[model samples]
Target: MCRWMAWLGQPVLIEELLFNTQHGIVDQSLHSRMGAEPTNGDGFGLGWYGSGEGPGLYHSVAPAWGDANLRELAGHIESPLFMAHVRAAIGSAVQPTNCHPFRHENWLFVHNGYIGGLHAVRRDLMLAIEPGLFADVQGSTDTEVVFHVALTFGLREDPIGALERTVGLIEAVAEQHGIPDAVQGTFGVSDGSTLWAVRYATQGPARTLFASSDADAIKRLHPDNPRFARLSAEDRLIVSEPFSDLPGLWHEIPQSSAVTVRHGGVLEHQAFTPRVPVSAAHA
Candidate 1:
């Protein structure tokens, strides 16, 4: 339904990942080979942390490929951590607020998935968002709601735990609405220091998710490449698809799994299951 990428590590111009990579998010916007749709032209968004208080956000209803502003911004902004996404609207309207890479204070989140039968259960899900966090709901897309649900469930405290709760609740509600196999997609979230990416679906396999190997290892493997030398060992990237076909550069995240990327580039993989269990996620 969408395509996204999150970068955490050495500071680099946004262009390095958004535009420079062979199959960067920008390219994927129009020529996506892995997304459910080949083109994610509905909208786009960019969230990055600089020397600011929180994070900087720029969103638009324009296709990423045709947005001159996006190109210019990417060329100018350099960040150690950021998230970007291109949308291919499924059931939501195309609006600036509905774009991915949704933000809240110091956190940024983006997803490439769908909540099955969202319309049928949207009201219940929205009502479930903690009233305190519910005020931030500015968009009408299920993706935005998912972000808030995670927040309500305590994403600020534990990204992995909160998300498991978030998904569990959604599936619980979906089942009540008679929607089977209610969730599908890959999700990425970060708080400028730690990053979490999840791949999951209620029934069949979820969409694709991949993480890059240590950049230093890449440099050693391709010593002749000048680009590799500029990368730091701490550089890490989690993407919906490989940026390139370079051997040993990317590893696919397992189904129903999550990757935790710490500030120092330490990577941890773990089996992520619905905390609420299918039949008892709800009281």
Candidate 2:
């Protein structure tokens, strides 16, 4: 598994979260608290949206903690919306293409769990992807497959629905192979403005996910906390774990739920149950 974070709001230096937090993503690369593994040193990636460009990405097969380029870039670059992920390969090749925050156009996607028995279902799932997207599949990882699956079902038009269908299709195929609990992940996707975070699994238990509280509320609670005061109510963050141990600043996303963060900072969570029920028959 892996650890990741998504930022949507003011264009602040990436260091603010990559290094400045009490337990930042860089730190998590070596000591993650809730990931399936503590050290996600296989690879890492960062994606951000600039003023006019759709999105820019930086990926490396280096351990995030030892990557000097990451530190230098984080200190210099800034974006209103950005995504960072630390990877721990789940039976996939450890390479740059497999590094996360996978991008297409302005959209960026990342995952924090695995698709069980991916090796068994890989061929079937890959064939189901649209021919155009299949041609663009550069990586050999379940995470990339999930991204293309969503795109195959129309992620650009309706992210939530497309993702739902993608997961359903995965479950359907996995069940046919007698693989139980085939899907397990906390996923995040953003199109520069709005962000959608999902916590779901074929089994009942899913990975941990959290979202920050209203920036305005945090400001009122800690008027002197310069960091809180600097952010507007619209600034929002979704993460695999809290960046800081700020009490009451982060809320755990309920299991099987999807959270949407819109432009201007409004955040909402909705309960999400997969349309195709997990068949315990194969379990």
Candidate 3:
């Protein structure tokens, strides 16, 4: 239902991602070939970490392609780590609060899938949130709730575990409501220095996720290509689809998997599964 991209490595003007690529995020806003819905015009958001305490956020209830202000900001901002998302409303209001890369302290999250039967079981999920974090709930979208649920489950300490628990909670509740295929999405979360991306579903294949493989190798093949100049060997990208149609440049993350991107250009992949809490049965 949406398209998003995250960058980690070298600080470059945001337009290099928002506009420069052949089919960058801004291009996907109007013609996303891989998203469930091709047009993600409902709203858009950008989160970037500069020389600040945390990431800077810009969200608007306007299409990414149509917003001149977003373009202006992208041209000026340079960040080593950042996320950009273009949204397609799925039965949710097109308000600024509902647009993503939702933020909590220094963490930012974005999703490209929906929770099934959310209307039937939203209350159950909300009540599952730790009271301390529940107070931060600000919108009606499932993505925002999922982010908080991850936080409630100790995302600050273990992102994979928190998300496993988060999805487990979503699926367990969906099962109680007799909802089929309870979860389907590719989620991306970052804490300024590192990024964690997950692709999972209860009964079907998770949504699309791909990461650029070995920027250094790509640079060797096209040393004159300017895009490769600003990026370090460790700089990598996790995107909803291949940023461009370059052969062997994008590697698809396996189904039910998580990819972690850290400094020094390191990327690690691990199989992922939901962790059903013992208390969930009683809840």
Per-model CA lDDT versus the true structure:
0.90, 0.88, 0.91
Estimate the lDDT of model 1: 0.90
Clashes of each: 0, 1, 1
Error of 1 at 20 (Å): 1.1
Q: How many backbone clashes does candidate 1 have?
A: 0
Q: Candidate 2's error at 280, in angstroms? A: 21
- The positional error of residue 242 in candidate 2, measured at the CA in angstroms, is 0.6
Worst 10 residues of 2 by lDDT: 274-283
Worst 10 residues of 3 by lDDT: 222-231
lDDT accuracy of residue 242 in candidate 2: 89
User: In candidate 3, residue 93 scores what lDDT?
Assistant: 93
RMSD (Cα, Å) for all candidates, in order, is 1.7, 3.2, 1.1
Off by over 4 Å in 1: 277-283
Query: What's the lDDT of the predicted structure labeled candidate 3?
Result: 0.91
Query: Best-fitting candidate, measured by lDDT?
Result: 3
Ranking by lDDT: 3, 1, 2
The all-Cα superposition gives candidate 1 an RMSD in Å to the true structure of 1.7
lDDT of 3 by residue, 1-283 (tens): 9999999988889998899889999999999998898899999999999998999999998999999999899999999999999999989899999999999999999999999999997898898888989989898899998999889888999999899989998988898899997889899999998999999988877889999988887877677878666667878999999888867678999999999999988999999989787677565
Q: How far in Å is the alpha carbon of 15 misplaced in model 2?
A: 1.0
TM-score versus the correct structure, for each prediction: 0.97, 0.95, 0.97
Candidate 2 per-residue lDDT over residues 1-283, each given as its tens digit: 8999999988899999999988989999999998889999999999999877788999999999999999999999988899999999878889999999899888999999988888899887887788888877898889899999888877899887778878887888898899998899898999988999999988868999999888877887788887787888679999998888768788999988899998788888887765542232232
